[model samples]
Target: MDICHEAPVKCLAYSPDGKWLATGSEDCTIILWDSEGQLVQEWVAHAGEVWSIAFSPDSRHLASVGFRREHAVWNVMPGQGAPKAMILEGHTGLVVSCAWSPDGTLIAAGSGDKTVLLWDARTFQLLHRLNLFTLEQHAHAVTHITFSSDGIRILSASSDGTVKIWDAFSGALILSLEGHTCGVNKACFSPCGKYIASASSDQTVWLWSIDDGSCVETLFEHRADVRHVAFSPDGMTLSSGACDGTVAIRHIRDIILVQDTDM
Candidate 1:
């Protein structure tokens, strides 16, 4: 229960099956814990601070990125004779965030290079650069990236104070949702894939309708920069964390239900 790293922990992820929890630290290492919070394994994952980590859909593999300009996929729960990790190259700037597609077919990495690189999950080969044009990508460092629940789209939050939606397979820009006055720290899709929630340095979280890219609601409770936001698995509850060390959980089922009814 008191597990820690030599440096500050930067990111964490829970396996889809709820069996494992993984944490990455500024110490350049990763620690794995069991569902009950018992330390299971620990390893050096990056030469520099590990900024982000994401578990595969089946909860076997983990994709991680860091201050280094590369991504690494680890076999967190290896069986007999399994490989430890695979190094991915191609980014020119520090890698900041990573995510696995919902179907386990693709892996996405967001970088300080201001682009999202998509990789083939099976072969570990580069799939798309995703920044063909300046308008199609973030104007600043990409802070976070995630695949939609349906696996058809990708959402990326950036220091440019905007979030962009993209067609997953074609690497085409779908929509750019902008409203935050300050940089966005994180973003995530609703479980139903109907909306996006973004946390910003502006000290608020904004909910956006995916259909029209409209600002559905703005939550202004945090006194400091809002750092993260996540929706409950059933797409009901919403949770946000702030730089002031406050974590807020809200019952959003009713709010979303009202929105649906109004539509």
Candidate 2:
């Protein structure tokens, strides 16, 4: 099935239930596609390019951020006609990324101002601003934000060439994972929560051990900036996408097995 957007798609996401795929575009609109590739719904979601979109854990809602400097949460469940959005405004700069917690209780937004804003999903309240502009914090725009599987930790990728993990509840900086020579575009924890995979503009994907905070493996298969990285639901496979127009899938079960054996 083929679908078209008026402008380039800036971000895309799949519902947790496997029912819908959402695409946000530079045209300032969002389109929801059913599993069959039929358009489920379409609406303008932001005043400018929509940088990111993420579905709630239950697939009942979607949180989006963009060049508009604010994040909007939309009720995307079936039968909700052009649902009203709860706008979260606190960022002093354009919002670049947003993610929903696995439990659906929180939303984290990262911005050009180099801070991650944590919001309560239920009340749509701004709970914490995760950066204080200290020397150790992100020196550049935050490129991505994600919550760990248990929702106890949050990760933020920055153009400063680092990924930082934070305590989700108290907004405390836990660990800083650094090594990328260029900006990190995205990062996410493995399903088992033992590792983190980060993609970078250096054209590499790095797998890091969370407990020891060390680079366990580095893959240099991409010829251009690596834009995204994710682990399979079962955590046996790793996938990465790059600006070179390719998706790379690697079997990571062996890597985990090797680590377990060494331990």
Candidate 3:
């Protein structure tokens, strides 16, 4: 077994190349380890628990967020050398999630304030703030966010039981997918951009068509609230981590169609 962390590991991710393992904790630290699970380095980035983390597709940069109100980045070193990593700032509320655009040109983060902030990958400057409407749309905290394969749209899930698609460049709302009876905790587009999967507190995962936002299937596999979901790089497998602490893998072939003519 691998000794992954010294505290409760909140979120974890593998580098695009599958060479590095990045783990975040509530102890205000982010640890980087090799594929073998041996710690290479750790950095303190926030005042409270580090809630989420994401690796740039290149595997050279890391973006981390925490509850105590801060966000940071690190230059991941492969072996024994030290790196002079840089920390970025600018969220007043606790940062809930972070992700890198496909080409790694932009970093997008969601927070408790019900907004998503976009940042320049190189300069680390705030590029835009995506504010979700309340009276007309989402009225609760934005729990998570993801970028589509082409990086032209942003997929945001919220505590309002809905996921909204936004134009990445203009921040204009495009589509909203709603079907889960409870709040959606996380949502991500399939690697091929053909499908979208969302994890919810309703104890189910919903798969929707990317083009029409139509419900494709409802995966009621997990016995408890689903906490997270990820599409394997090949887009053929789906993995979900639940509040029950079980990571369940669902193959794309198993997502049943709601209708015989469903695309």
- Point to the candidate with the largest TM-score: 3
lDDT of each: 0.79, 0.80, 0.75
Between prediction 2 and prediction 3, the one with superior lDDT is 2
lDDT of 1 by residue, 119-150 (tens): 99999899899763343568887777776777
Extract clashing residue pairs from model 3: 26-49
**TM-scores of all candidate predictions against the true structure:** 0.69, 0.69, 0.72
Q: Give the TM-score of candidate 3.
A: 0.72
* Tens-digit lDDT track of model 3 for 1-263: 23434555566666777666666665677777675557778777678877788889899988887786677877787565665556666677867888888789988887777777888999989899888544235788677777777879878898999999988777788999988889998898876677888989998989888778899878877877877777656666666656554555566765533332455
Per-residue accuracy of model 2 over 149-243 as CA lDDT, tens digit each: 77688788999999999987788789999999999988988878999999999999999999888999999878778776767567776766565
Task: lDDT for model 3, please.
Answer: 0.75
* Model 3, runs deviating above 4 Å: 1-14, 18-47, 81-85, 112-135, 167-174, 253-262
Q: How high is the lDDT of residue 33 in model 2?
A: 78
Cα deviation at 198, candidate 2, in Å, is 0.6
RMSD of 2: 4.6
Count of backbone clashes, every candidate in sequence:
0, 0, 1
Worst 10 residues of 2 by lDDT: 1-10
* Predicted structure with the largest lDDT when compared to the true one: 2
Candidate numbers, best lDDT first, in rank order: 2, 1, 3
